[model samples]
Target: MLDKTLRNFDIPAFQQDLINWYQANKRDLPWRRTQDPYKIWVSEIMLQQTKVDTVVPYFQQFIEKYPTPYALAEADEQDVLKSWEGLGYYSRARNLQTAVREVVADYGGKVPDSPAALGSLKGVGPYTKGAILSIAYDQPQPAVDGNVMRVFARVLNIDEDIAKPSTKKLFEKIAAELISTADPSSFNQGVMELGALVCTPKTPSCMLCPVQEHCRAFADGLEQELPVKTKGKKQKTTTYAALLIKNEQNQYMIEKRAENGLLANLWQFPMAPIDEIGMEHITNWFFAEYGVQMNIGDKAGTLKHVFSHLIWQLEIFHAMTMQTETADERIIFVKPEDLRLYPFPVSHQKMLKYILD
Candidate 1:
């Protein structure tokens, strides 16, 4: 029955209904108004794994700060990371700047429109490439993101795990087949709009869906169970002792993270992982790392932060170095008011507020 329905699917009618609805109902987004490939690329990257409401203000400010590819490519990496401080995913900002620099130096300051050229950029993937090409260049490429996958899962009654790579490839092919050649931009955005607004993950508004009559899962009364996705592994937790050291100059001691690991280059107070909570062990570890013995005072506070793959349990303490000096270049002393100048991870940001207050 599924095969029969698939074979008889009226691709043109479905495309037309979806696009027409999108033309009239699609939200007015900043990136939707321009044909500039650069702006579109930024929006596509910012929208990844982030909600639209959360990305709007950030998008506006970023575009205003770095109006062109050259503007962003030439800006300091620290400034770029600062702009993206609260956005989580620090790598996205770093990769975006790297990609933009390539576009400026190699691509003549214009975002490449071809798949080969665009995909070679540091951060442009298949999904992002399709979006830029279809929207900026009017190409019929498919942007198969989570929203597209979910909508198509119900449309074709596909029970394949949406989390698998094979399912995405299948959906990409299906998207390519069903895309409206005449209006690829609207068709792609329409599918995304439908998934985001009408055909939501929970309690989809089937009656209001433009292509409700054509949805296979709705016909089979399996709208709620069509998209199968495997669960990801549980997040692992780690404990750390964060040191808040203040010197005679009224400056706080902070250190930059390693240049290659998680939260690379972001600023944070001196911290080291611990097996358990103990002031003695924490100070000893600090001494080993910095070659400066420190005194552990009263406990400032404790903070728990969650990431996509890991959880952090931070035990913050009021600490002071015996020598009152950090010799490492990565370590710096910043007055309380100047701490905001450096970009710190959310976990560290919370620590600063705790100790400062």
Candidate 2:
């Protein structure tokens, strides 16, 4: 009886309650103001794994700088990365540019109104494809992201692990069946808004929820336990001794990262993986890596930055080099004032700010 009840929900009341609540209470996000697929695309991409408050200023500045796909496509990749510097997950920026360039070349600078055409984009996957389709074009497709999935898990009282790939399809299918054909835009956004606000992960405000009457988990007092997710693999930590090499000309030595792999094509201070941060170790590494000997100074500071699956523990030290000539094309010297022109990872940015301030 319990198993069958999960699938047998009041579809009309659920859809209507969500839509009516959302139409009346949805937050006035900047992205909600415009229906342009390009803006919507940019907002959705920026909002991935990021909080709405944090994305607001970045989105406004980004849109103000690059108003259209052609503007971004024609701009330098370094400049694009600079705009997305602290956003983390630099690959998303790279893939967005690649997809927009395709849009410019193939779709005449317009985002496609169809799912098949939009799904062919470089960074757009199943959820993104559905989001752009439903929100931008008002299609009845389901946008089952993590937030929407949480909403569905409790509303339907399902105990499947959301972290698994197979469970996503089940949620998507149910969402498709439950979506309002009259307003897919509101319906999808409503579920996302509900999850973010009322049906939150840890402590949901069940009494205030518009769909509280329709939530099986609320009735059974298991709202918090409905969306069962297995713990992800533990993050790997790597320690590094980063060199903040400054020359007499007020120019600092910064190196461009490799074109591929993690934080690809970004700029950073010279770093060497080592367990020690002594002056002798720093001097030897300087001569070995760049063939330029330097006077190692006091320890600048320590920084810890966390990525998706890796943590970088860095011990930064200030070093000076009178001889700045280097044979490595990847290495360049820039004044502290000009560091803004280069895109550094968040960890390096913090180190620089500490010294500069």
Q: Rate the local accuracy (lDDT) of all candidates.
A: 0.88, 0.88
Query: What TM-score does candidate 2 reach?
Result: 0.95
RMSD of each: 1.8, 2.1
Model 1: CA > 4 A from native: 1-5, 276-279, 322-324
Error of 1 at 199 (Å): 0.9
- Residues 284-354 of candidate 1 have per-residue lDDT tens digits of 66776776676877889899999999998888888665455667878887888899999999999988786
| Alpha carbon deviation, residue 319, candidate 1 (Å) | 1.2
Tens-digit lDDT string for candidate 2 (1-357): 333644668888888999999999999999999999999999989988899999999999999999999998898899999999999888889999999999999999999988898988988888888889999999999999998889999988888899999999889887888899999999999999998998998989998999999888899999979799998998989888888888988788988999989899999998888865554576787787877778878788899989889899998888899866698888898888888889999888888875577
Compute the lDDT for candidate 1.
0.88
Which sections of candidate 2 miss by over 4 Å?
A: 1-7, 276-282
